[model samples]
Target: MLNYSFPLTAAIVATFFAAGLVKGVTGMGLPTVAMGVLGSLLSPLAAAALLLVPSFVTNVWQLLAGPQFGMLIRRLWPMMLTIVLGTVFGSMLLTGGRTELTTVALGVALVIYATYTLLAKPLGVSPRWEPWLSPVIGLVTGLVTGATGVFVIPAVPYIQSLDLDQDDLVQALGLSFTVSTIALAIGLVWHGAAPVGNLLTSTLAVISALLGMAAGQVMRTWISPQLFRRLFLIFLLLLGLEMALHGLLRT
Candidate 1:
């Protein structure tokens, strides 16, 4: 696993900045990007630790800045609560000696998410079904998050199923991601993977992430979002393929 000799290594900053840049453009994917870039050099737990602050800060802002804050909370509280529970329950897999398992899980998650996004048709859920279905999705999403430090798979897809406008969907994503970050933080601490000891490096990562977000925002204006999304999914598919292969071959 990678270790830090300096408080603020350029590698950490650059990795997070690149991750933040992706989230800035796409409105999601900080953890996915950060995990992919850093997981090779460090264990997944250590990489996840470095991303905690950036993910939390950014997602909190995304959550609060939305017009649907109160309404979304009321609608999503059940799912959110279940997500927390699921994380704690699933923390059993966040142990120190399971790097290969986590790596394989991470790769599988990326592949699933990218493939779903690219090829899956739009799905819709009725208002009546939301009462029961929401919690189920939350639990499953949380378990996957606990296992792999990446928390987008079913959660993002489920959130997309809700018939929300663009802004509302973005806010919903922020809400889900914020909860996942907190849950992952707790799970990491429970497993002794928390970056509490590396306070300076983690703090600096937040700054780098924010800077990358700013650049991505600028780039967003210059490019077609549809095109960018397509390109991003393709990149993820390839990245996930390589990761999965590497882990399986190593094992």
Candidate 2:
């Protein structure tokens, strides 16, 4: 069992709080932000374990906030199933003493996600292509999530491209995130990385995240969405660079 000093506990709370604030303002990024910060101090799998419960609860709230739950689930089932399977396979590898590779992979994933956020315009996908593309994206995203515990790259962008109404889009993201979180949790447990004792700390993280989310909700009305997004992307870019450098140098 790992020991948690006062400073470590404080850092974890602060990190999750900030991550949740970003999620509240942007409708995404809790895992991304949490992983980026926590990965610096802990192994990728450990960081992932810490985030499981908080991500699940918040996403559940987001998922239930809209009315198209059944519709979205039906349309996205193939992708969801593929995500789960891919995550299982990837988790097996991650738990097999591949921490260094997983850290590098997380860094690369973050850089790619940040680059896309900075450069990509809003894309629209034709309905005709959804059947062919959704499963592929889901599989890739699941693999990435299983290895690195970050699930927002290809999945988030693909969902955004669907051009659903704002409510549906939010709900879709929530559904995807909720599923991904649960799947990741299961993966962690399967790998023996997530123990029952972690649940207490995870619950504390949930509270901090919720408080931060409430504060961010108030700030959302004051901040312009475009500006907030740009700032968010910039932060991710810096964090990604740091993680990549650290991982490379350490290796």
Which has the greatest lDDT?
A: 2
State how far residue 85 of model 1 sits from its true place (Å): 1.3
Off by over 4 Å in 2: none
The TM-score obtained by model 2 is: 0.96
Error of 2 at 199 (Å): 2.6
Candidate 1 segments exceeding 4 Å error? 1-8
Deviation in angstroms for 27 in model 1? Answer: 1.1
* lDDT, model 1: 0.83
lDDT of 2 by residue, 1-251 (tens): 23588889899999999988998898888999999888877888878888988999999999999999999999999889888887877787556676777788888888899999789898989999999899999899899889888898799999999989999999999999988988888888887878766766887799988988887888899998778878988887887888888778777
Error of 1 at 203 (Å): 1.6
TM-score result, candidate 1: 0.94
Q: Show the colliding residue pairs in model 1.
A: none
